[model samples]
Each structure stands twice: as structure tokens, then as C-alpha cells.
Target: MKPGTSTQSALPKLVTCPTCGGDSVYAPSNPFRPFCSERCKNIDLGAWASEDFRMPTTGLPEDQKTDDEQ
Candidate 1:
């Protein structure tokens, strides 16, 4: 054990930004991690807000759907 040591790991992990496909720091030091920058983060956010990213759904009507579909 050393004096004045941190519990956090010394090495930070690097990850690919989803929006820009660039390298990003996956640590607390990077506020907009996993997205590279605010622009890329916002772009991803906008996509979500605009319903561009969604889960797959069946094209059946709600009334015709079975109990499993609910």
C-alpha cells in the first residue's frame, strides 16, 4: 500500500465514438465520452429524439395482436 494513492485505476479506457467513429476517452475526464465531442453527442441525441433509433415492432394492429405481442 502507498500513501496518497487513488482507488481509481491509472489507465483510462479508449472506446470508439458511436456517432463519429473516432477514438474517445471512456473515463470521467471526458464529459462527452462514447461520442467524441458535444457535436457528435448531440447528433446522436437528435437521432433518438427524432425517433431515428427504435426497437423492432410488428406491423400488426393492436387489436389483432395476441397476448404475447402485448
Candidate 2:
């Protein structure tokens, strides 16, 4: 054990990447956080911009439904 290096009590949390389904670092040190890399992050952003991703449809009353949903 080096004097300057201290042992970590626990391992860093490895979160599942939303884009690639690979292990991703969820710590502050990871700039991409939930995503594995900039590429994966950008891919998710592109999907949002292209309207490829949509929120779950919740059944609403006929009057509450949006014009597009109707």
C-alpha cells in the first residue's frame, strides 16, 4: 500500500448504459454518467430531436385527448 494511495472501501457503481446496455460509470468522474460515452449520449439526443422517442401513452378521456392522439 502506497502512502498517498488509500484503498477504497467499496467499488464504484456500474450502471447499465441506456444506449448500449453496457456497464457505465455513474460517478462524478464519468462525464457521460448514465451513458457509456459521448457517442451513446449523442445518439440518445438525436432520437429525442428526431421524435423517435415517445412518452408512454396514458389513456385519457375523449375531451382530454390531444388532436394528434384522436
Candidate 3:
């Protein structure tokens, strides 16, 4: 190792938690990375389920809803 460089520097940088923006450890070695733990992971999952995330649609097929309905 170089005099100024340490083994810790070789390791990945610390990541911030997505949900709470808190300090998080790099868990790339584990399957659940980016998230600090299972709890934070679940919180993100819940947001997806609750429609906090949305995908835009140009318009429904003409057959679906009438012109009066947007």
C-alpha cells in the first residue's frame, strides 16, 4: 500500500439512505444495497405501491374513456 493511501480507501464510499437521507454503509457485497437496511427498503417499496411513483401516459385508447373524461 502507498504511504498516503489506506485499505479503507479501496473500499466503496459511504452511501446516503434514499428515504431519509441518513448516513448509510455500502452493502454492495449484499443483495440489498443502496438501502441501509430492510426497514428502509420496505419504506421505499410502500411508496411504489401507494402511487407515489407515476408513469405518464399520452392518452388511453379511444375505446377506453369518452372525450368528456380526461
Candidate 4:
């Protein structure tokens, strides 16, 4: 341990690339490190735009029936 080394300098214990799933240096302070680069981030965005990711929703009512419909 170097005298100038601060405890905060320690990198993330887990080394994993979130996007490409390749070797990556994890950091608690890094925002895009897991993605490796911005390109990966865009890929993820495209997936959502193309409906690759679907989220369930209650959705709007289709029929205008009364609340007391038997």
C-alpha cells in the first residue's frame, strides 16, 4: 500500500463489462465504464426503441362502459 494511495482509489471488486460482457475495470465512481463506451449505451437505447424491451402497463380503457356494468 503506497502512502499516497487513498482507500477511495481502490477499484470495484467486480471486473465485468456490462455491455460487451468483456473484461472491464469496475469503478464505483465511473458512470459509463460498465458500458465500455457510449456506443454500447446507444445499442441498449436502440433495443428499447425497437420494442425489443416490453413493459407491461394497465393501459387505457377501450370501452366507455359505465362503472356499474353488470
Model 4, residue 58: C-alpha shift (Å): 14
In candidate 3, residue 10 scores what lDDT?
76
Please say which candidate is ahead in TM-score: 1 or 2: 1
Candidate 2 lDDT, tens digit per residue, 1-70? Answer: 7677766644688999999999998888899989999999999999999999998886777678687875
Task: Give candidate 1 misplaced runs (Cα > 4 Å).
Answer: 1-8, 61-70
- Each prediction's number of clashing residue pairs: 0, 0, 0, 0
As for candidate 3, its clashing pairs are none
Encode model 4's per-residue lDDT on 1-70: one tens digit a residue.
8797779556454566656886665665656666656787788778888998888887557775566764
Q: Candidate 2 or 3, higher lDDT?
A: 2
Q: Each model's TM-score, in the order given?
A: 0.68, 0.67, 0.57, 0.46
Cα displacement (angstroms), candidate 3, residue 57, comes to: 7.8
lDDT of 1 by residue, 1-70 (tens): 7998866677688999999899999988899987789999999999999999999986877569778866
Q: Model 4 RMSD to the real structure?
A: 6.0
User: Model 4: residues >4 Å from true position, as ranges?
Assistant: 1-9, 12-15, 28-31, 55-70
lDDT by residue for model 3 (1-70), tens: 5697678657776789898787677756644568777888899999999999898879777779875886
How accurate locally is residue 15 in candidate 3, as Cα lDDT from 0 to 100? 87
Judge candidate 2 at residue 68 and give its lDDT: 82
RMSD of 1: 5.6
Better of 1 and 4 by TM-score: 1
lDDT of 2 at 66: 81
10 residues in a row with least lDDT, candidate 4: 9-18
For candidate 1, which ten residues in a row score worst on lDDT? 4-13
Off by over 4 Å in 2: 1-9, 58-70
